[model samples]
Target: MSLRVEGLCVARGEAVVVRGVSFSVPLGEVTVLLGPNGAGKTSLLEALSGILPIQAGRLELCGREMSRASRVVRARAGLSHVQQGRVVFPTLSVEENLRVGARDGLEEAFRLFPELEKRRHTPAGQLSGGEQQMVVLARAILSRPQVLLVDEMSLGLAPLVVKRLLPVLKGLAEGGVGVLLVEQFARLALSLGHQALVMNQGRLVYSGPASALLRQPELLQWAYLGRSA
Candidate 1:
């Protein structure tokens, strides 16, 4: 199954943020969305998660149309979003946070990130940045989503911590979950992605194999800078 978007448009109030975007995130593959600031990557991810309404166009998951589904409906339909920043309840214990995601799957989540089991009773705010990110990830994993949208997951984190976290996403993709990732670190995202798409000012400028983009930095530079390669 795959998550498909066609002519997708999103707006914030009166201003359009994403314009006529079309792409597909297939099962067992990582599709990386790359662009510089104000490139509309986050807006597109938010639309896919159903947090932002689609001003136009269509969305389909597993071949079923979900263009107008609510955020909660999308979540129940196997969609999980790990937004920018390590979002967790600071006052709640780690277990409590996971419980919020789902009452079960604690063991599986802990198995994926064993460090969490040791800190299960600790308040999430007390954990290190990386550890807190793990909690967010573990919570998403516990939900057992078929399609995962991760927006700027590595922001404000150390390189080592990012290294540990990204592989978990890759592993999830390998195990038949479609992962749509928007990462600030383009090189690292390209390395893990199977397909890549670049955006510029709310439109897709490039779409191709991740390896192809790696071999051609100028294309990426052009898309981000509006310069001739």
Candidate 2:
């Protein structure tokens, strides 16, 4: 049930962005990817989601190879990705946008973010940033993914809101949903992660217990503050 990546290399045109990265995400655990900006965290996630082709690499999502597969195949196999920018359709009602994400029905999504039930008829564009985030997260969960890739889960939110989301993520992890939480907040990211990896220049520089990351002030300052994380 884990997402295993081996010798992953991603590129755009002639420029290599992620170079030979490798890691394993055990089932139900929260494995976080941390790095400064331009560390290729998002790019790596995109490749796993099958939204971007892996120029060179091997990815097994819940035991199925995804590098050469379609995005739909990846979706059906419990690999869900919630991108940084909310991608809800503006023209669609909140419920409609959610319905699009639901593989089975809307109830799964509603259960995750009950507020959406109240805003079911409203257009997604009218919602606040926090609300929009809920929509994206709930929608991803609607598919009943075993593995979830969350990009910047704390971005553009108040500290209180971020605090609230952390518990939900922890609950998910406890329930056996493997999560790859890509974030810029070093302190917060390490706290939620059972394990963490730091990436730089398209390569992984560190892979160990998340607790180890909290102890290194120099690494934390360099990883987050160095490049606008």
Candidate 3:
């Protein structure tokens, strides 16, 4: 496994947003995290990436314990998080944004996102939503992380645009990176995932093969309602 979590818990101020979550993101696979709104999906990703402090439980990256590690430490230890919003330096060019992650990875980033190469000199703010997302993803990829945590990469984008991006994530998994994806489009995400996990109200209600969940809609519905099938 590239990333492992055991009984992980996280609190937002006084309220606990994530409760006793445990899972493993194996290398060379995409693990889709599905849940309803306010189900703590984003919180779990934040905790895993060190954006939020882990109140309890263990976090291991490539077999190294890092529960108490800072965000910088986690990033350096081969973890990269492409957050919900397409965060990029508005005035910076696509090539410049990628270089911020790793100067040597510019060509590799351009190769993965040829569209970005065409606009290499264009400022990020001028790109469309889909293009901006590509820049964010490319920046994360430039880091060459062992585990990638992405939250809502499809937010506010057209379905066709989302479809185009999904394959890239799968390709990353095929190339030995463990991808933990938190997405609202359950069906779309499951179609590309090797494993599926369903969360409800800060707790995991389902964990199994992605194909299994895809085949059984009732099971997924039950999980969304915080009940066992």
Please provide, for model 2 over 145-220, each residue's C-alpha lDDT reduced to its tens digit, 9 standing for 90 to 100. Answer: 8899999977888877777677677778898999999976667878888988888888888788888777765665
The C-alpha lDDT values of all candidates are: 0.91, 0.83, 0.93
Better of 2 and 3 by lDDT: 3
- Tens-digit lDDT track of model 1 for 66-175: 99999998899998999998999999999999999999989988998999999999999999988988999989988988999999889899888888899999999999
- Which residue runs of candidate 1 sit more than 4 Å off their true CA positions? 227-229
Q: What's each prediction's TM-score?
A: 0.97, 0.90, 0.98
Give the TM-score comparing model 2 with the true structure, all chains together: 0.90
Higher-TM-score candidate of 1 and 2: 1
Query: What's the lDDT of the predicted structure labeled candidate 3?
Result: 0.93
Residue 178 alpha-carbon offset, candidate 2, angstroms:
0.7
Q: How are the candidates ranked when ordered by lDDT, highest leading?
A: 3, 1, 2
Clashing residue pairs found in predicted model 2: none
lDDT top scorer: 3
Q: What is the lDDT of residue 21 in candidate 3?
A: 90
Note the residue pairs that clash in candidate 1: none
Clashing pairs in 3: none
Task: Choose the strongest candidate by TM-score.
Answer: 3
| Candidate 3 lDDT for residue 68 | 96
